[model samples]
Target: MEKERGYNMQIPEIQITKSWRKSISMSFDTQGVLQVRAPKFMLSGQIDNFLLKNSAWIDKNFQKITQRIKNKKKYLLWRELQNLETISDLEQYFKQEAKKYIIPRCNELAQKYWFTHAWIRITSAATRWGSCSSKKTLNFSYRLVMSPVECIDYVIIHELCHLRQMNHSTKFWKEVFSIMPSYKIYENHLKNEGWKYTL
Candidate 1:
């Protein structure tokens, strides 16, 4: 791991790993440290050049991660002040919010759109907002309650559309668009801001 700050921008420590790979790739770890994987025989100069070339991309993502860290700290402080310290406490609260808000909203949309589902289940899923099973069961992440209402509806309608079309084919998106013409804005909102919807 090299700690030298060669790039002009102020970035986190760069850790380089030499491997038997053909290319150089870089990404940030959970702590916002930049991790680079390069070919074993790659020279230091080559790696520096790679970093320089991708400085803008690195800076953008680093700022985003920094904001996320700050937001998480604020959330923790608020939780501590509110005495909601335990994971179970947060989970229970999220589940209650999901059931009270998401379930009824899902039912309303289904009825309005003439969509049917076998059931709805709330989960602790972190990677995805919602999914639809082949048996017409819809599973949503309890974390989704933290997102904006429009994003929440987008996820609900997205999974509901899957109840009609199992795949993300053109027809599936068509169904989603038919119900919510502005679905892409909500989808992009989730893609950009959904990371904050965490415990």
Candidate 2:
């Protein structure tokens, strides 16, 4: 069964593309890379797997992307599972133990940028970092506590910007860049390491 996601974490998902006739292998790298083994005929792109930033073609065929990822296995190693206690320090930390360090930074940046966030919720879903609804409620995945702090900040700022602009229109990105000039770098960094956890 899938583990429960904590209030501040989300699992990172990766896209895998292969011929409908071929089988593929999806695995994470030690440095936290999302690797998809497939036939060359079907090329794959590693993205945040949350919302694709470039949506010209994606928006029209969104399901096409979402439907392709491999499903999570019914069971996982206790150590690989996301929770409060680490397998190593099974005695001391929870899988999402890292969130304690992330939420405050998110709030600080949101306040710094003038977002009227009603509350910050943390979770451990492997597919998303942060999300903002029209209600002004923010939801974050605890998996982020494992990522670099810069990446954590980027997701927070990205979602927080959504409070002002809900879509990825040029203006929305402008807001993201206003607060994070190196947003792209951190985005790539997240993509590079984000898919280790299965959602």
Candidate 3:
């Protein structure tokens, strides 16, 4: 059943939790659920008044929060359906995907951008999508295969640029932009959707 709070003004969906704290507070969780934490001793009217006072702000952010929650639930269901049960399953899946798609694409981009590297290694790292060592060796995440080709290309170009400038100085970004004019678009895509590839 859906939990709701009643107030003088019609506020969006919210879940209220009673706490021992002295004051009332509110926030949107990562899943975009609006949560209100109120003093356990506070009266219902006081809470309603507080909600009324902040109704405008709530209304302003309501649509965005609800949409975020919907998108999160949708992705959760999609990921669950994949049945990726073990680390080895995820690793093997991504490794084969990297060999089939990432390696060939990397070769194509390297040729197009005239970049060189010592070696390429596909990894099961969760923290980073890719990295370039000072030794010119390249490391990539196998899960990257789940992202769009544009994001994959961005990661490739991003690391390949490191062949010239190892650090993320203006020169490094300049190298990335030279090959991918709209790199930020794909960059943001990876940031928003990359976690969906996880096991």
Candidate 4:
């Protein structure tokens, strides 16, 4: 049988099944269903208590899966996904696009910001969009090209600013703000919607 529970005004449907199993177990499945399995003899009060105790965990994992599916759908909608049948095709596309776009854009921003770096290289990193090393060399993900021009410039300026300040402190932010006044808008975009660019 199934029931609904509301937490913080968000109601997540839960399905409960009684089985021969000895203990209560909670799980989430690929179809975005939350399931609670209980011993056939267990009381509903015990089951409700178990779910209540783990509500936070359920909320967190459920949101993660929901967002992941949304992102996958967004990624699939991109025209590039249609032609990309293999991993190598995706890699080659990123490399070529990075060379054509990311490198030249970084060069332009570095000049505008009066920043100097040893060099910049493009990568295929899935998580980190960019990084700067102690040696002043900058590495950026090819996926960055998939972002808006504002977001792309934000990432570049962020890494170049690291050339002066290695850590994310007030001084580092001052450097970034000096270049892009509205960077937070693009930064938030990267945090919220940037997952659409992933393969």
Candidate 5:
């Protein structure tokens, strides 16, 4: 069964779904709507108490989602993408730009740093900027083009360093620092602003 209930001013409405599940779980939807899943036999009062107990967690996550939505609205690339008629067009544009910029830049950095890799691949990953496989193949998100050039170089260097140190051990950081002394600045920039890189 499913029903919507008003919780409080901060949370507004919560969509509750009851099923044969033995435990209760909660999460926020893409639109920032709170969703609760509870055992079918649980009472509404019990659910209310559960929500009250977790109000702090709800408030914190809700604020994060709200801020992410606001930032996306203000994102320059996201705004520019509004002119595209379809998601496919937007993805194609990202691929074209990533190939044009990232591939050449990666090659230039690899030569400058004396790093060699098997191959590089661009993907549509949303959760991470780049990855290096055990096979020496490097994978980067096409969304990385949305970042500043320095941030793009940081990611490239990071992945190239991975060819030497696959793990993020102290030695890996040393390799990174050797190439880009100010890598932390670009790292933090991506951490703070990477959310805006999504489609």
Candidate 6:
């Protein structure tokens, strides 16, 4: 009877025009909106009843989905700032802030969306802005310090999201986008400034 919070349930009612010769699947999204995969001959009323019968499961899975998004973890990784004497003190400071601020912010964002995972980390990576290993260790590039706080958070959260998802599937992006609507802007910011940097 109560509506779900923290998630929008705008599931466009799907109209089936195609035929399926096999069995079908059905479920609701994390937001508690129902979705049914049915054959062309299946009655809409039956689908509706099926959804009604599974309301409790729908609610539970929806919460689970939200947790899967918000509970993502970050893994910090970076040994001593090694023999790159060519790097300036200011650059080193930036790298340090990147490690510090990025990790906490990512953790907060993960909680907001209901994602939980094992670890978080920061690193001096060149090509990769961030990475989420299968082991759940999140790796963020030290170069994130070069960008604004918003851009850095975007990258950090993006990597943290990979803890729940391994690929760039629609669901993965959905989880990422749900957490940071402004994520796209940060992505563009990275691209524009990417050429300016030596890396």
Best by TM-score: 3
Q: What is the TM-score of each predicted model, taking all chains together?
A: 0.69, 0.53, 0.77, 0.73, 0.72, 0.51
Candidate 1 lDDT tens digits, 126-162:
8999999999999999989988899999999999999
The TM-score obtained by model 2 is 0.53
- By descending TM-score, how would the candidates be arranged? 3, 4, 5, 1, 2, 6
Instruction: Sort by lDDT, best first.
Output: 1, 5, 4, 3, 6, 2
Judging by lDDT, tell me the better candidate of 1 and 5. Answer: 1
How far out, in Å, is residue 2 in model 3?
33
Clashing pairs in 4: none
Q: Which residue pairs show backbone clashes in model 1?
A: none
Q: How far out, in Å, is residue 122 in model 3?
A: 2.1
User: lDDT tens string, model 2, 1-199?
Assistant: 9876555432344455554545555554432334555655544343333234533333333343332332122123433565423355532243345447666787788778888888777765667777888998888877776566788889999999989999999999999999999999989967755764333
Tens digits of lDDT, candidate 5, 1-199:
6656555446535899999999999999877888999999999999999999999899889988877767776775556566654556778898888989999999998998898988889998989999999999999999999789999999999999999998999999999998899999999989998877776
- Weakest lDDT window of 10 consecutive positions for candidate 6: 71-80
Instruction: Give the Cα error of residue 191 in candidate 4, in Å.
Output: 2.3
The residue ranges of model 1 lying beyond 4 angstroms of the native Cα positions read: 1-61, 74-88
What TM value does model 4 have? Answer: 0.73
Tell me the tens digit of each residue's lDDT in model 3 across 41-94. Answer: 999899999988998778777766766667777776765687554345766877
lDDT of 4 by residue, 154-199 (tens): 9999999999999999999988998889999999999988877776
**lDDT of candidate model 1 versus the reference:** 0.90
